[model samples]
Target: MKLTVVGGGSTYTPELVDGFARLRDTLPVEELVLMDPAQDRLDLVGGLARRILARQDHPGRITTTTDLDQAVDGADAVLLQLRVGGQAAREQDETWPLECGCVGQETTGAGGLAKALRTVPVVLDIADRVRRTNPHAWIIDFTNPVGIVTRALLRAGHKAVGLCNVAIGLQRKFAGLLGVEPPEVHLDHVGLNHLTWETGVRLGGPEGEDVLPGLLTRHGDRIAADLRLPRALLDRLGVVPSYYLRYYYAHDEVVRELGTKPSRAAEVAAMERELLTLYADPSLDGKPALLAERGGAYYSEAAVDLAAALLGGGGTPYQVVNTYNRGTLPFLPDDAVIEVQAAVGAKGASPLPVPSVDPLYAGLMANVTAYEDLALEAALHGGRTRVFRALLSHPLIGQYEYAEALTDRLIAHNREHLAWA
Candidate 1:
């Protein structure tokens, strides 16, 4: 099978390449294309990708290009990981929101709205190009604001699925704590992308015995520590919320913490520089250890599994993915995209039935879904009013004054990217 990576020049590409090399039997890629507009970075990342494949003695051929159509033409699948405005824009996304005394994050609050607006249009254009070239090809989006972007692709009638590393990362962590293989631990993961909870941890499969209570009884503190949440909160909620939830559960505290520390974008920019320098070394054949600190833990494994299943190859039958809800949760609209465990195959992902959600979580999910609706509107049809409404609707920035301020800041910082600005 042929695969294309649109943002193959990203520092994250090496981790993906490493997975493709190790999991060749699962995906069996015949050709792997890395497409990026940044020619210099693409060359560095592409060279490392080739070396990684060759070092593993994989039979797949790796190619690099700057042309989007050339990279995607006739591919079996296309993975979107592009950043519309790069790290500099991300720095602004992470910075300006805090000025409103709100959480500064890339996938939630005002910052996430900015990312959604900047990303959706670009992703839609790319999806349109892919459809024109290879109508049968599947689009796997790994980009930030995945829910919004995936919604855009699906709404535009593209064959697409969204992938995130959060579920896989948590699975690996839980497995280590339970002394079992990652595949042996099945999470009852539900909710929207980046805003999800592990309601249960089954031992063998989706129908296997739920061991969540036992896990909490034994490793609650450790898991809570990893999530940067209080152990008492986990015990009370009786579910493990994704780390991103910290922005909600402790909004003021998180904003204070964010104000004190350097933006994550700044740190990542520095790491990318070092990573690029390392990639230039001809002797470096494996993904550098520093890449792990760069984040997207276990991204490759998740991508491989999702791609394999979508292409009718060998992959885990049930995995966590973002797709149309289709009434998996009674509280959410059927068209709302949610992250949950599903039986994935060539047909697409179908979210498994989830137990009744506690109002606490369900209420938040509903609220965010509404905000996402407005966010997509602004993304599709840009205007200051749409932007302000999205910010006003977000639970994190519900106040009129804060929403107005954030809307202005978002537009000012992203005027170049927003055509209507």
Candidate 2:
């Protein structure tokens, strides 16, 4: 099988490629086509892939290219992990809104709309390329504005699935907090990207959601009693906690009441990094860090593992995927894409349907859902109206006049950055 990895410049490429390498025996990835706008970094990642393949005793083709058409041709799957602009662009997303009273944030609020505006065309262009070159290719999207892009792809009739590891990993954390084995826990979630809520948390099949709230109600205080919630936790968050639960705690009442955002998930990642540093040092007491993992391939390991599992017919693995709502999200717009649990298999991904979400959770999401809709419209129209509407309707950015003023400022400040006025 061949995999086309877009956005090879990601720091995570090391694990991503290594993940594929580990699955070599099962998938035997014959080709790895690494595409990136930055050719130098693409070359760097390609070199790492070569070293990984060399040591793995598996011979395969590794191609690095900036030519979009060449990179996507005939690939079984394409992993989309691109950014519209890097950290500088991200800083603008936060700081421009900070000029208003609106909280400076990423992935949600006016900043995310601005980002979606910039990124949608890029993602659409890539999707078009995949359509022309690899009609059968499955786009497993890791790009931000995931719901927007996924909807665009589906509306345009392309095969795509929006994926983030947060749900897979977040549910596991909740299970741990509830003092249950990880495998015993199951989650049902819906809503816009980085702005979702758990409608149901349970054990076993359809029966667990009923007991989850009560279990959490009784056990949650015990979990929170020892773990102090700090404000600076965003500094070290591992994978953005399913969606934007961090921001939810800060703004959304349902999330605050659920007591999840205060879980200090970032502290866990940060503390783990600290321990890793200690373990990796020569004078450290813990186990030695494996030298083979110093390369880039390890970064792609989970991605490749998941890919291989799907292709190899591993058990029905549930994934948090962004897909066309189609009925999975009962309250949200029908055409819009929402991220939720999906059962993945050889056939493909099926979005898991949960009983309707909570009124408070649904109410909180309605505002953000409008943000996603307006962002999509803005991307399509390239005008101020859609952006303004999205901004005016956001929950966190409730100050409409202030939001409008911020919009005008951002447009003026980012004239060079925006493709159009």
Candidate 3:
């Protein structure tokens, strides 16, 4: 199977490439294609990936190209991972809204809307090209504002999937806290992206042995003992939350007892700065150790080794993201295609649905839903007014007047960023 990575020039390509190389023995992959607008970086990563594959004695040929047609032709799956303006712009996405009194988590609200405005057109163009090239290929999107971009792709009637690991990652983390094996735990969740709440949780043992009552009885008292979350949530809501722990839990009664919200931007900014510093720190050595440390962190391995699964009657129990509601998920709009779980095979994919989210999460997500939806409107019309409306509608924007002012300033600030219609 020919597997193509559309944004092969990403700085994280090395880690992702290592992931693919690690899967050499487990998955049946034949060719690895690196496609990007930046041929120079692709050539560099492509050369290195080929070397790594050969050194491992695996047999997938590596090819790098700037031509979308040349790179994606006859491919089984396409991994879409790109940044329109990199982390600098990402910082702007996050910080600008925080300055405006909005919750700025880098992936929601005005930040997300800004990103969607810039990225949607480029991604849809890729999707359209995929239609003409690999008509039957599965597009696995690993980009941010994934919900927005995937929504747009589905609206345009393309085969695309959004993939975010937060849900599964949360499940596993909670299982660890519960001292149970991962697959043995059952949870009910809903909402979009990082905004979600778990409604029910059951620890599986023998069928009749309900672990929930006993387990919570013994250690449930420790739940959020020092954290902002209420320990009674274990008794009340019935499930542990999976995402937005930092923020949602921050609102627990005890924390809210402080009166006003404390800004954690410095803390969050420090983390981002540290990572950027490390990525840019050329003088730092131990490349091998660093590679090993980050190798498995982002699940790049799962991405790297997908070629064989697509062609050889072998199916990896991994998720292939697509943008289509078509009834696969009951919680989201039917026309939407979220990056939910799915099995990839020669025939294509089938998305699996989980339970709907709680009312709290649904309300939280309602804030961003309009922002996400409006970005699609902006993309389709090249409408600056729509973009303004999206930004104005964010939960953190304080007032519509402020939203309009911010939009006006942003338009003046990012004048060259958009090609106004």
Candidate 4:
């Protein structure tokens, strides 16, 4: 099978390449295309991708191009991992929101809305091109604000499923803690993308015994530390929230802390520079361990599993993915995209039934779903008022004054990306 990676110039490409190389038995790629506009980074990352494949003795031929059409044409599946304005823009997304006394995060709050405005239009255009060239290809989106982007793709009638490493990362961590393989650990991962909670962790199979309580009892401190949340909160919630929840659960404290440190984008920018330098070296064939610090942990495994399942090849039949809720959570609109365990196959991913959520989590999910509706409206139909309304709907920016100020800052900083601005 042939596969395409749209944002192939990203420093994260090698980690993906490494996964394709290591998991050849699952996907068996024949040709891999890396498409990006950034030529220098593309060359560096592409060279490393080739080296990685060769080292693993994978038969797949690697190709690099700046042309989107060429990269996606005749592909079996396409993965979207692009950053619309790159990390420099992300730095702005992660900083300017702080000026409004809000948490400066890339995928939540006003910053996330800014990213959605910048990204959705570009992704839709790319999806249009992909459909024209290869209507049969599945678009696996790994982009941020995935729920919004995936909703856009589905609304526009594209065959797409949103992918995130958070579910897989947590799954792997749980597996390690349980001394089992990653696939054997099924997470009851639910909620919108980035904003999710692990209500259950089952072993052996989806219906297997729940091991979450045991994990919490044994490793709550470590897990809480990893999520940067208090252990007490985990005990009270009786579940683990994704690390992204840190921005919400501890908004003020996080804002205070963000004020004392460089934005994550800045840290990642520096890391990407070093990673690129490493990629430039002809001797580097394997993905560096430092890439772990770059985030998206176990992304390759998730991508491979999802791709293989979607392509109807041999792989895990069930995994956690972001797809239409379809009433799994009756509180959410059926059209709303949610991340949860699903039975993935050639027919596409169908979410498994979730046990009813606690009011504590369900209330937040409902609120965020409403915000997502407004956010997508703003993304699809650009207007300052739409943007303002979207921000106002967000729980994190519910105050009209903060919403108004953030709307202005978002438009001002992203004038070039926002056509209406």
What order do candidates take by TM-score, descending? Answer: 1, 4, 2, 3
> What is the C-alpha local distance difference test score of each model?
0.95, 0.65, 0.61, 0.93
Writing each residue's lDDT as its tens digit, candidate 4 over 1-421 gives 9999999999999999999999999999999999999999889999999999999899998899999999999999999999999999999999999999998888999999999999999999999999999999999999989999999999899999999988888888888888998878888888889889999998878889998998999999999999999999999999999998888899999999999999999999999999999999999999998898999888998899999999988779788888998889999999999999899999899999899899988999999999999999999889999999999999888999999999999999999998877
TM-score of each: 0.99, 0.78, 0.76, 0.99
Best by lDDT: 1
Candidate 2, superposed: residue stretches over 4 Å from native = 25-27, 55-61, 174-184, 203-243, 252-302, 305-315
Better of 2 and 3 by TM-score: 2
Model 3 vs. true fold: TM: 0.76
- The residue-by-residue lDDT of candidate 1 on 314-371, one tens digit each, is 8999999999999899989999999999999999999999999999999999999999
**Per-residue CA lDDT of candidate 2, range 45-162, in tens?**
5666666666666678778999888888888888888877665666677666655655555466667777777778888889988998888888877777777777777878887777
Candidate 2 achieves a global lDDT of 0.65
**Stronger candidate by lDDT (1 vs 4):** 1
The best candidate by TM-score is 1
In model 3, the runs with Cα more than 4 Å from the true position are 171-189, 198-237, 245-296, 301-312, 316-323, 327-332, 338-357
Residue 213's lDDT within candidate 1 is 95
TM-score of predicted structure 4: 0.99
* Model 1 segments more than 4 A misplaced: none
